[model samples]
Target: MSTSLKIYDTTLRDGTQGEGISFSVTDKLLIAQKLDQFGVDYIEGGFPGSNPRDISFFAEAKKLKLTHAKLAAFGATRRAGVKPEEDAQLRTLIESEMPVLTIVGKTWLMHVHEILRTTPEENLAMIEDSVRYLVAQGREVIYDAEHFFDGYLDNSDYALRTLEAAARGGASNLTLCETNGGKLVPEVHKIAAAAVARFGRDKVGVHCHNDSGLGVAVTLAGVDAGASLVQGTMNGYGERVGNANLVTLLPNLFLKMGRTANCAKNLKELRDLSLFFDELANLRPNPKAPFVGQSAFAHKGGLHANAAQKVARSYEHIDPALVGNRTRVLVSDMAGRTSLTLKARELGIELDERLPAMKGLIDELKEREFRGYEYEAADASFRLLIAKWLGQQKTFFDVENYRVIIERHNNQIWSEATVKLTVNGEAMHTVAEASGPVGALDKALRLALAKAYPQLQTMSLRDYKVRILESNQGAGSRTRVLIESGNGKKIWGTVGVSDNIIDASWEALRDSVEYMLMQS
Candidate 1:
């Protein structure tokens, strides 16, 4: 039988500890649901006793109807001089009603003697009492030996004693942790190999940090040494440098190690999972993250693109589509005719290599790009260019004029804007007031055309980004605005450039509205 490597996800617990990462209770439950859908064996929701948000999260997660993953509640072992039943933290873990309970405790001598301020023997007692109490209460317990590798290095027998304590107390899994994330892969494998020999391979698990950029490497090394279960945060989200990246680890385990997991069928959803999670957190997806990144399968070189178009494996490690991503031959100044043909095909543009229009389109793109028009980031603008040149764009609405004014009274500010629009030979004028200049302008424009274009109500700007183009005149530099808008089903981006910020914003907004109407 193939070895079954269990996947334990700690995104809600450990991931939130990373710098610049915070998720509301709703985000946590949503992420938990997504993780469960992706077929992870366990989801470490949060530390129930840590705070009110986590407590609420556990209460709500019960109603999410999660099917694939068992919910695990995390907390520390019972404190010194307290009975396991008397510890509030342990009680809170039970109250969360999670099927699995994971308790972390001091394993390193320095943490035991200096940080915990408890005797070595007392720490051992704490671990044993905490695990035995939970297991007796019908909880499947997993004992995390905090700083296990470091402790093993300092005092091998003492560290081994901690694992033994948990095992004796009925912990189903003895998870060795590289808490500080400074251990080398070889050191991790050696200690983990010894741990597997002593504890038996089926009982060992590995959790690691990314301080030295070797979290994933060391994690796989531990599995190579005999760990059957792996604990990591999605996208390697954790404190310090971060934890091991399960995005990279999962594929490595499946393809490289030949280990089978429940998530094998869901592996194709890995890219979408990474993107959706990052989007819920309102963070930009890392375009360069291994395997699932936007740039992972992007080919930029002319020679490389030509060869990839012929045979993908010739210039790539594996088929990008294997992980639900596709090969993208980037069209830039370095692009060849073959690459351009591929791009045109992707854009759904019927093209001919013998036609001079393709060459003309390339020249136009390069010229426009030289004047602060970046087609790479402003893909919507590039698409509009192609459609316009092909006579495929529809005429939406025309703007005759617009006016905006801001006035302050009694320490409060109000702005008003007037818009004059011509739609299909009908003239409409409207005025609106709002909290800011942009809001007032948007409201006025929408009011002018809402009667003719009812679909305007469904379109709203999702993101507006402005950049000041570099100029020798310094303060007189031009401004560029990119507006991302979405209807109920689809989203698109549009761009505008002008000397004034308001005009730039207005132009982009107009294009966005027109783009929506065109689709409707």
Candidate 2:
């Protein structure tokens, strides 16, 4: 039978230590519920004594009815000479009323001597005293031997004694922490194996960081070395270079390593879980992240796309569906007929590569891209192009002409635009004013179509990006504009390029409206 591993998530505690990561009490509560739903074994709430946000989170979290994950509170072991019962931090931990308590204690003799200003034996006593007191209070104490790997290298005997002390004091698990995050995979495997032999497999856990860029590797190595518990943060968020990524580690443990975890059965929710964290963090998801990334299973090259079209395994490692992700065929200038065919199929469009129109479309795509059109980032534009080539594109409206004027008077500037278009063979002219030329144009255009297409009212421009194609040309440089629009339901991207910035913006804005109408 595969060894059942305990997945101890420190995302709420340690993950908040990462730069640019901050969560409100409600955010913490929501994430805890999500982790429980995802089937993680433990959720480490933050240090209650550190900040009111964490204290508030613990208070609110106690009311949350988490289904699977046991709520764990994180803190350091009682101070150098302080008794556990008298320690304010320890008292706060107990007041938080969490069932599982993880207390990090100094494992390195240098920390004991220099940092704690205490003797090696005194540090051992502190670890024992803290763990014993917590256990006596009916808490399942998990002792985090901070800097265990580095301390073990410094003085193996003293490090082994630290674990023995925690064990004697009733620590349910002895977690060997690679605090510096600089330990190699081999070193972690060897040290973790030795610790497991000394303290039994079920009693030893591993916590690693990613300073060496091997947090995931070393974590897997620890598991390989018979550690039964794994501790890390989701999305690799932590202090410094971050902790071993449970987002990356969970799949490795359950799928690649054939290990059983409480979360193993909910493996299909992996991508959603990763995305959920990114969304809450307000950080753009890493497109290149393994397993759950947008580009993880995206095929771009012609040959690669062709092979993937014939046999998915030719380009993909495992079935993306296993992790709730799907393969994407990116359409680019380098795309072959097979690539276009696959891309078309992905978009729910029927395009037979053997058709003569396929060759023309490919040639046109290359020519357009050579002229600074990027289809990959503009899916809506690409779909429109396919429709035009296939003679299936609808002509909802036709623009006769558009004019934009900017005026600066009395230190105030304003832009006005006039648009003339025909909707269903009826001439329509509209004029509007805004703060910028693009904004003016958008207002005028929408005014012209408001009555004809009320659906465009909910659709508004969400984002606009402009890139100069040729910097050397300076004032005469060709500009590419990308616009993202949302109709309160789905979002789509469109692109346009021209020598004039206004022209480029107009092209993108027009395409955005056309794409929305086409869909409607």
Candidate 2 weakest lDDT stretch, 10 residues: 351-360
Predicted candidate 1 versus true structure: per-residue lDDT over 1-520, tens digit per residue? 3578889999899988998889999889889888989999999998886788998999998787878799999999999999999999999999989999999998899999899898999999999999999999899999999999999999999999999999999999999999999999999999999999999999999999999999999999999999999999988889988999999999889877888799977888899998887888778999898889988988876789889889889987877776788887666666656766776676666666666666777777667556665544455665666667667788877889999999999999999999998988899999999988878888998898899998899878778888899867587888888878788687777778887888988887787777667666
On residues 1-83, what C-alpha lDDT tens digit does candidate 2 reach at each position? 48899999999988899999988888888899999998999899989878889878888888988888899998888887788
lDDT of each: 0.87, 0.92
Give the TM-score of each candidate.
Answer: 0.88, 0.96
The parts of candidate 2 lying over 4 Å away from their true place are 406-414
Clashing pairs in 1: none
lDDT of model 1 at position 70: 93
The prediction achieving the highest lDDT against the true structure is 2
Clashes within 3 Å, all models in order: 0, 0
Off by over 4 Å in 1: 24-27, 59-66, 300-304, 314-316, 329-332, 335-340, 397-422, 425-454, 471-473, 517-520
lDDT of candidate 1 vs native? 0.87
